[model samples]
Target chain A: MNSTFANVVARRDLLRELTLADLRSQSQVSRLGWLWWVVDPLVMMLIYWVVVAGIFGRGERYAPYPVFILCAMLPWKHFTSSLNAASGVLRASESLIKSIAFPTMALPITQVLARFWHHLFGLLVLFATSWIAGLPLGLALVQLPLLLVFQLVLVLGLSLLVACFGALIRDLKGFLGHVMRVGFYLSPTLYGIDLVREQSANLGGWMADWLPRLFLLNPFAVLIGGYRDVFFFNRMVEPEMWALLTVQSFGALWLGYRVYLHFDRRVIKFL
Target chain B: MSDAPKIAREKNAPVIEARGLGIWFNLQSRRRVSIKSILLGSGLRSDQKVLWALRDVNFEVADGSVLGVIGPNGAGKSTLCLALSGILTPDEGDVAVRGKVSTLLSLGAGFNRDLSGRDNILVNGAYLGMRRDEIQSRMEEIVAFSELGDFIDQPVRFYSSGMRARLSFSIASSLEPEILILDEVLSVGDQAFQRKSRERMQQMMARSRAIVLVSHAMPFLRELCTHCLWLERGHVRGFGEAQEMLDAYEAELAPE
Candidate 1:
């Protein structure tokens, strides 16, 4: 990995300019402007709580199911929404990319950052809900600051590949969303991880063991499970599992960044 | 802080260099993208027919000089400028530039239409490789030079096309670029802005850096350029001192 790559990309300020510009334009569109970033997502969470909470024997599973789902869904929402925003970034910025010298992955990087700003608001709401529900808090939750770093690297690295592909093939936008949706259900979010192990001696058990451990490459799962361990149980994230997760997250990151850099120089000419 | 020592730049090396420079459109060999296919959403492939905007062209511009490029409608002038700016990669051959470049390919080629004039100024400042502090220091000068009135606060799309041109040109020329590229963009404004454009070019040229002026106006080329290259249908027919090339090119343009 090039040590200076990220810093150089950040210095270009194209991403910064575009982000500030996006924020400014967004603010002018409505009087309630920037606040909509938070209010919109919280409203979606509320709707899901009202609709889905009542349907499944969702209450039987655990404490304050609404907040639990929100905690799990918060980072997931960011991951998915970022994919949607990033996929079209290159195609839309034909002017900037074609005419200037800068990192192409800055497109996906901006998408991740803008959505991260939105996700941070959702996280605050999660903390508030946890407090209202009277859930226990401990040092386990502090892992968030560290874990989110890995999540960001993973997201930035992986989404860049998809953004490039999306530029070439327009349908990649819908394809990525559909794929993430499937990953949502397949993941242990909202549901327990044991479902797969329950069918041990078969493919289900095999998947359960590998999915959470190996696929910790997915920072969201580690984040969600870490949330459950910290708030729901007041326990520390298993040290061994954390190690596995860290390696996978950064490993995916290293490879993805290479792919992004490999194609960056060609983007201007192609566009 | 380090006091920089002055060093002489090499003499033999050209300030601008292009060798056998050729750029061609992909001409994706497919019968798609025609209006019939586009309306029906059926033709997803590209057409295959090579269109050479520039071919086997060769030129060298020395340090502290002015080079004018003149050609007819399809003479690859803008393509050459784009290559110089590193915006387009040549399919064959190479281009190397010694110093920073600020290209005025068109009035609004790089500006965001939806942004306000002030916002576009900041955007252009950063696009021209100015640091934040650098742009902030000069922000007022840019605004005043634009003479945009209260319209500067409104989205650029709300302004007349001429207003957008003024903002882009002012912000771009406000910075002293080592290599300046002017792409026939001066004809937009009224006579007053044209005079200002010429004045700005003269001031920039006075700094003793190389520049490439591409225009169809042979008289202006003759008047301003220290050297000139006359292009005819993607070929360079004359390249030498400005007056001589212009004389040769004009003779060719005469009825025959």
Candidate 2:
């Protein structure tokens, strides 16, 4: 038990080094350096806003849709990029995996943490945009930290699950790209929860009552809703919803870790 | 020279023990099998060929002993080193290692081409389970041993193959792990550096509880190894005293 604890501490240190190296390599390779972190999402926000708001005039219900979309877009980018990296991480570190005996899970965990550094930069941009848009920067904003933590737990869990399968299935990386694209549309990024609620009411049947509820089942839907609530609307997601999302996030983490443990040793052989 | 407590070193107590160890690899799935092929039912149509890289091999290395593994190319010597180092899981049987193991499996195995030689040392040291402060403290010694001098700060992508090998050897040897596993790494760098590395490896051998080395250098193996294991086609062809095994290996290589 004592040695296992020591091993965990050593693994944490290794994770820290790998993550720092990943972050450093990422910033060093590009001419723009870390600016790309903020700029990438900002550009993505513009493209998404132009398509969903400017062309279709769909997001007017949540006026100043750039800020609205950026809130969710920033977190969504974190999710997508982390998962994408996790899918190919084992293959990318093939030589290292073959040579060293460190915990294999560290590869995906390092990717997720390194991407979180970029997400923090995106959050700064989100705060700046929200402040300029005259969104409330009040007591409600304190909830942002908790929301970020929950999203991180949620992302880490999903990344582990994806990484385990990704090690075995060479096509998973490409397949994940398509899945994330479809997922972007499914989540309420361009639109608001209110729009979904109103549209459901317009259906005027059991469909109206159950449609929005069904959408909330997606952890991202609940998470993005929480982000919009804190940053843009200056409100709180319902406590019950917060509780449910928290449980779901941890559930994903537990399930991911379980699956990773089941396949981690076998995964190394494949790599 | 050993850093481990004196009480821990019981003379001739085995630090590494392998019992009927076997490692097998699927020939067809050695390269990653894509989900597309599996879903198309093509994967099911093929009969998998399992190649036993090591089969029913057993050995034990006691404290303060060096074990040299010698075999021709494709003979699974490197596979045994990997299994003992705890990198590759055994497909059959078991290997029990009682101490921390450090391996020089391949030159520059974990290096990031964009990072400098010095940065790679820190990264590689961490991968070997060294703490940040520990690596920092040993940074100068490791760099000096590599003898890369001014090139230490240059990105590894520009490094020559010999320079990368020297850098990796320096990092792996400097850690002073309880059990050291070396695979064809002693032939690195220029002749002068090779001699220097050999002397450094000798010092490590003195300090480490056990050392497992894979090499084609017969004279060097004869000088260093207390025991030798000769593998042929993933089977133990011979195992005994260094002189006897080396004589047998050389006699087999010479014409009748």
Candidate 3:
């Protein structure tokens, strides 16, 4: 037991190195350099605002639709990209995987961390836009990092699952891409949760109560919802919401971690 | 024989120990005969065995000692290297490594081919458990040692096998390890670099770090190792003081 703990701790040092290499590889192609992190999403926010908000003049009602979408989009982007990159992290680093005694989770953690750090650039833009556009800051903004912790735990677990499974089955990437495509419409990123509840409360049908409960447990749901509360609602997160998010986070983490550890030794061979 | 227990209790105990180590390749059949197909009278022979890579190998090395693992072709030297490096788990017996180790099994095992030379160094250093600053501190030393000149900025794939081997060796030896496992890497470089590598290794050994060198070069084996393990057909042909083991191993291969 003590040896296992020591091995796990020894992995952190390697994780620091992997993270730096990851960032360096990411930043090597820079005409605009690290600015691209903020710019890529800023460009997307503008494009969405133009087509969806400007053309339809929905900005009048949504007020800062950019801010709304930014909040919703930021975490969604983080979650999906983390999942997408993680799906290939082990396969991509096949050489390192085969040669070293690196902790298997290092791959997923770096994927999640890189995506999370990249999303921070977009986040700085969000906070600045919220202030400049007069969305009004609240004490809740201070708590967003704490809320993001739950989201990260949930994503970390999901990344582990995706990385291990994806290493074994090459076709899983396609299956996941299709699932994310369907999920985009189903998730509350573009539409409001109240809108879904009002119109499609029975959309879940047989699993009505059970499915939304599971769907809300999707990590990004709580994540984007919490984000919305901070920026849009300007109110503190409800105690029940925070509690449910914690449970959901732990469940994702536990399931993801177990799956990862089970297949770790064989992942490199499969790759 | 009298010193076995004393040796076991010493500081930096034989960095690697393997007793009865063996690896069997259980590759699933290429053409999978489904259960339905088999039941429908599609006859197939399911049992197949091609190679016994390593079989019932036992050996020991002392701290700060270099053990040259020399073998004939297909004698399981690489498999032994993998087992010692913890890359491949054995099916029988056990292998235990004390403290940290750096394994240079092959030139580019941990290298990222797409990344620049500098980036591969960082990745490789991390594989050896060096932090960013640690790698940073040793970066100039590694680059200078490789002597790739202006090509250090280029991708690793652009370099010849020799250059890749040099960089790998340089990064590996840069970090002082309690255990260093080398697999035929010294022979990859040009003659000048080979001499340089041997010198660097000698300096490393002077600090009392154990090195397990695997090669077919008997001269190299005679030059460095206090002990030589002669592996034949995945089992020990002889193990003792360098010259006696090497002579016995050569006589076994000399003639019928």
Candidate 4:
């Protein structure tokens, strides 16, 4: 573990360069250029807005549903895209893995950072759209950075785990998309957490109470909830939520690191 | 090109030592298993076969010497190079190296083609364990060695394959690692550039305490190496002085 940290610290610049290179390689071929990075999420947001607000008449259910969805959707997009990219990144970097012998963790970390770059751009668009929608921008925005740090840790850990397992399980490359799809519905991406609580109250059972707890157990729900609290509500994350989010992120990271360490040497053979 | 007192040749002080080093790959059985077969409790037994890429390899290379590995395709030359450099762990036994190791196993690897040749240098150099400032300081030398000139700033995708090869080789050579493992990357660039690379390698070898080269070009190995190992089907066919091993390997491959 000490050696692993030393290796990462030693190649910090290389990691940065690899992350930048990922972004450049992705955006280089497109005619829209770097705009595509932000445009992708923007388009997805518009599609959701059209379906949920325009067709389903969900616009009236929540005042400015676009803002509500954007806050959660953008972060969810970051998480899903990062995981998706990270999972297959090892197989995608078949040539690089065969050629160079750097830390394997660097590959997943690079994926996380690359998606984070695009997510950061998408986030700027989100903030602008939120401001236009009359969502108050205030001291709560300061909590945005804290939330980002926690989310980054969560994403990095999951990415490592997925990347490692995805290397071993050939079916996982395709299956992960399905997993993320299920995760999207399970998470509070398009809907409100309060909606779940309200529905659960109407059901009136132990099972109903457990359903909301199940949602909270998901790190994505906790993070999306935290992001909404800061971006829309302009409030500090509750102390208990903060503790839970911290524990979840770091716990995932520790587990991911252990898994990576177990599989790092074996990854080459799998690749 | 930094002048430091070279370690004098000392008997029994090996820079790299491999004791019964072996590496194997588990080839996944191609027989598809369906849910029906699993439910019937058939095809549940493991069908994985182990392909030993390298087996029972043992060698000790001292400072101020080059160990040239010569082998035909699938002879585990690259596997040995990778294990020696700490890239691939051996499935059995162990390999120990006493100094910083750098490998240039394949060309244009880990390079983002969209990035300029100069940027690739920084990334590759960092991969080889040099710090950013260290890579930056050697940028001019790497560029000069690669001779890409104006193409250095252009995206590497446009460069010729030889040009890409030159860039990768130059970066690894510039690092001047104590234990350098180069796997068949020396045959790069044009004839004139190849000559320059050879000269550059000679200079790098002068500085590096130990070097391992895996190449199909036997004469190149004969000229550069003090000792050689010839591999065939993951087994060492010959290991001795360069001239003796080369002659024996050549004899073995001769007609009839």
Candidate 5:
């Protein structure tokens, strides 16, 4: 038990170092450097805003659609970017994995942490935009950190699951690209849960009763809704929903870690 | 030199022990076997050949001794090193290791090419189990040992192969781990640096650290090693005192 605790501490130190290395290399390689972190989400927001608000003339329900979309978009980018980087991480770090005796799980965790750094910058942009758009700051904002932590837990779990299979499957990276593209529309990034409920009610049957619940089960649906409530709608996420999300996020993490360990030895051989 | 072997073997406690160790590799799937191949049943082809890279190997390393592994190319010396260092999991038997291990498997194996030498040192040091504060404290010593000077701050991609060898060796050595594993790492750099490294290794040995070295340089092995392990075609050909093993190895080479 003592050695195990020491092992955990050592792994944590290695994770910190690798994440810093990843972030440093990323910033140093590009000409614009750290500016890209802020710019990336803003650019993504502009494109989505133009399409949903400008071209389609949808988003009439959510005024100041930019802030509404930015809140969820930032977290969504964090999710997708982390998974994308993790999907090929084992194969990409072949030399390091082969040479060092450290835990392999650090590879995927580093991706999540590095991307989270960028996500933090996206949050800064969100706060500035909220201030400029004259959105009210209230006690609802107190729940922001809790929401972000839960989202991080969710992303870490998914990243580990992807990294484990992605190392062996080779096709997971491309497959995940498609899945995330579709998932983006399915989540409440561009619209609100109100839109989903109203659309579901139009169906007017058991489909109406089940479709919204099914949507909420996606985990991101709950998280994005929470962000919207805190940042745009000025309300707390429903207690039952927050409780469910807490369970779901940690459950995914537990399952992901189990799956990763199951394939951990095989992964190095495959690589 | 006469009493060196006896002095090296004076310590009786084994720091490393392996029994019936084996590592198997799928010859047909040297690269990653794709999921598409498995789905299509091509991965199930009976033509796949399994290669036991190391089979039924047993060895032990006592504290304060150097065990030199010598073999021809593809004789599984490096495989044994990997297993010992805990990088590769054994397929059949198990290896037991005590105390901290630091491995220099290959030059620049974990160094990020885009990062500066100083940054790579911190990163590699962490991989070798050093904490950030520990690495920071030893920063000056590692840099000075590498002799990278102004080049330490430049991106490692700009470094010459010799410079990388110097930096990696310096960092690994600075860790001063309980067990040090090296795989042909001392072959690079200029002759002066090689001699300096050899002297540094002697200093480490004098301090009673265990070492696992793989090299083709017979004279260096004979001079530094107390025990020698000879691997031939994934099996142990010889294991005993360093002098006896080297003599037998040289005899075999002369006939060929």
Candidate 6:
């Protein structure tokens, strides 16, 4: 047990350096460079704004729709992209995985860290925009660190789980892409939770009542809700919401870690 | 050895010990039978077509000794190197290494070509078990050793194959690993660079690091190796002193 702990510490050192390298290499691919990280999300927000505000005419309903979406969109983007990249990291690091003896977990972890780095930059842009829009900076911003910790644990777990199964199944990438696409609509990134609750109430039944609660059960929705609650609403997260977030984060982590460990030895062969 | 005691076996224990090591690969059939299809109750053969890359292979390497692994193409030489380094777990047996191991299994295996040579050095160094400060301190020395000069600042994709080999070897050797595993990477760069690397490897041996060198170069093996193991078709054909195994391997290759 002591040796395992020491090994994990050593692995952390390597992970830190490799994560920096991974991030650098990501931006090096294009002449536009790291600007793409900022621009890509801006473009995404623009599309979301045009579609919901222009076509659906829902933008005025939310008033400050961009900030509303940005709160959830930024975290959603981080979660999805990190998982997408991490899921293929083992296969992507084929030579390293086949030749080196370092902890395999580092590959997926570096992806999460790199994506999180990009997400933090994106968050900076969002905070500036929020200030421009006259959204007051409150003590609620302090909740960010705790929210991020929860999100990171959840992301790390999901990434490892997907990556392990991804190594064995050639079609996992395609399947994941579809799942994430459906998840985009299912998540509360574009629509407000109150909007869903109000609409579901018009349907008039327990199913309608369960719909909002069920949306909260989607961990990403809960995470987006947390970000929205802290940064936008300036409200303390509900106690039940806290319990749900903690449970989702730790539960995903436990499952992911266990799945990764089970497949660690077998993954190389499949790859 | 199955029931061997957990402790109290330190009578000149080998730095690396592999017993009954085996590994197999599944050969994907011409048409991949999807798991979904199988679960739906198709009658396709669920038993995978297996290719045994290594089977029941066993060996030992002691401290201060150079053990050479020699085999032809597809003879599991590279797999043996990987297995010893703990990259590939054995299916039937186990390999125990007493100390830190650094492997040069392929030229620039972990390098990000988009990154400059200096960054690759930092990454590869960290991966090979060196700390960040240690890599930074050794940076210039590694560059000087690789003889890449100003090219060290350029992205590695611009580097020639020989340059990549030199950089990787220089980074790996600088780590001063207790167990060094090389896989046909010593024949790197020009004859001058080869000679220089050969001298460096000899110096490593002089420092008493247990070395496992996998190569097809017989003369090189005879020159440096204290012991050798010959493998063919995933089976050990010979294991003994370096010169004897080289002689036997060469004679076995002679035409009838």
Better of 4 and 6 by DockQ: 6
lDDT of candidate model 5 versus the reference: 0.84
lDDT for B21 in candidate 4 is 81
lDDT of 5 by residue, A1-271 (tens): 0112235455698889899999999899998999999999889888988998899998677978889999889989999999999999988888887777777788788899999999999988888888888999688999999998998999998998999788877688887888999999999878888888999999999878899998989999999988888989888779988998999899998888888877876677778
Q: Model 3, range B1-256, lDDT digits (tens) per residue? A: 0002212445655666778888765344322334445456642444554356788888878766788988887788877876666666666777776756667655567676657899888888877677778988999999999999888999876899889988988997886767777778455489999899878877776764678888777887888888888877877777789888888888877989
Worst 10 residues of 2 chain A by lDDT: A1-10
* Residue range B1-256, candidate 4, lDDT tens digits: 1111123435666887777889997765233333445457763667568789999988878778899998789999988877776777778877778777777777778888888888788788766667778888999998998888899999988988988888888887787678788888466789998898888877877888998988878778888899998898888887889899998888888898
A3: Cα error in model 1, Å? 13
Better of 3 and 4 by DockQ: 4
**lDDT, candidate 2, A1-271, per-residue tens:** 0112234455788888889888888887898999999899889988988998889988777877888999889989999999999998888888888887777788888899999999999988888888888876788888888998998999999999999788878788888899999999889887877889999999988989899988888999999988888888888678988988989899999899888877766677677
lDDT to native, each model: 0.71, 0.84, 0.74, 0.81, 0.84, 0.81
Listed per model in order, the count of residue pairs whose N, CA or C atoms clash below 3 Å is 7, 0, 0, 0, 0, 0
RMSD of 1: 5.0
For every prediction, compared with the true complex, DockQ reads: 0.28, 0.48, 0.27, 0.39, 0.43, 0.43
**What's the true lDDT of residue B6 in model 2?**
21
Tens digits of per-residue lDDT for model 3, A1-271: 0112245566576666667667766776566767888997788788879977879776655668888788877877887889999988877877765566556677788889888888888889998888888977888787788777987888887888888877766567777888887877677776666655555566766655665666675656777788888988788888878888889888888888778777666454456
True contacts kept of 5: 0.64
* Model 5 residue pairs with clashes: none
- On DockQ, the candidate that comes out on top is 2
lDDT of 2 at B57: 95
- Candidate 2 — which residues are off by over 4 angstroms? A1-8, B1-12, B44-47
After superposing candidate 4 on the true structure, give the runs of residues whose Cα lies further than 4 Å from its correct spot: A1-3, B1-12, B29-47
TM-score of chain B of each: 0.84, 0.88, 0.79, 0.84, 0.87, 0.85
Clashing pairs in 6: none
Model 5 chain A worst lDDT run, 10 consecutive residues: A1-10
Ten residues in a row with the worst lDDT in model 3 chain A? A1-10
Please identify which of the two predictions, 3 or 6, would achieve the higher lDDT against the true structure.
Answer: 6
